[model samples]
Target: MTNENNPIDFGAFTEPKKRPEPVSAPEESKKEKGRGERQEWVSRQPAAEPVAPQKATEGQISIKGPDHIIERFKQLCKDDRRVYYDMLEILMDKFEGK
Candidate 1:
């Protein structure tokens, strides 16, 4: 009998589990694919290139609250656009300057 609090010895199981062989890489394409051709096949391109970095405005304040706070804020706006705008208005006024 083993102690309930003692860790189990997995050493008794020495047999290694056999794994399936991995698939080999696909053979290289004989034909060359141009960038334009790839783009045409893609239903949608990824998001637009990120905006160019701008120097932070002088005295600009940035604050980050917990995920719960953000989640709650989002929940407060549950399917309502006005609630989101109102919350932004209050937040901007309260913390944008501090």
Candidate 2:
């Protein structure tokens, strides 16, 4: 028989408390908030045209290869086109026995 005077504690099996939602500020337009006066409104200019690559000299010749080879060459160059061109020149010089 349970004692009628003693109360049973059910704290361990209680549900987790829910956190209160954060209150958000009201969104206001820049014009209405007088922010437009404080900030400068600069109009965006048109993008400049891309310059064409310079023509290769009389001694230089352009070679077209497979896309994969070109991509690998670009990767090997590591952001410097001179490295790739220099390597090609050295290879050509060695092959020509110069």
Whole-structure CA lDDT of model 2? 0.70
Best by lDDT: 2
lDDT of 2 by residue, 2-98 (tens): 3567565555466889999997644454445665543456768657877889997656567799999988777767755567668777768999999
Per-candidate Cα lDDT values, in order, are 0.65, 0.70
Worst 10 residues of 2 by lDDT: 30-39
How many steric clashes does model 2 contain? Answer: 0
Stretches of model 1 off by over 4 angstroms after superposition: 1-63, 90-98
Clashes of 1: 0
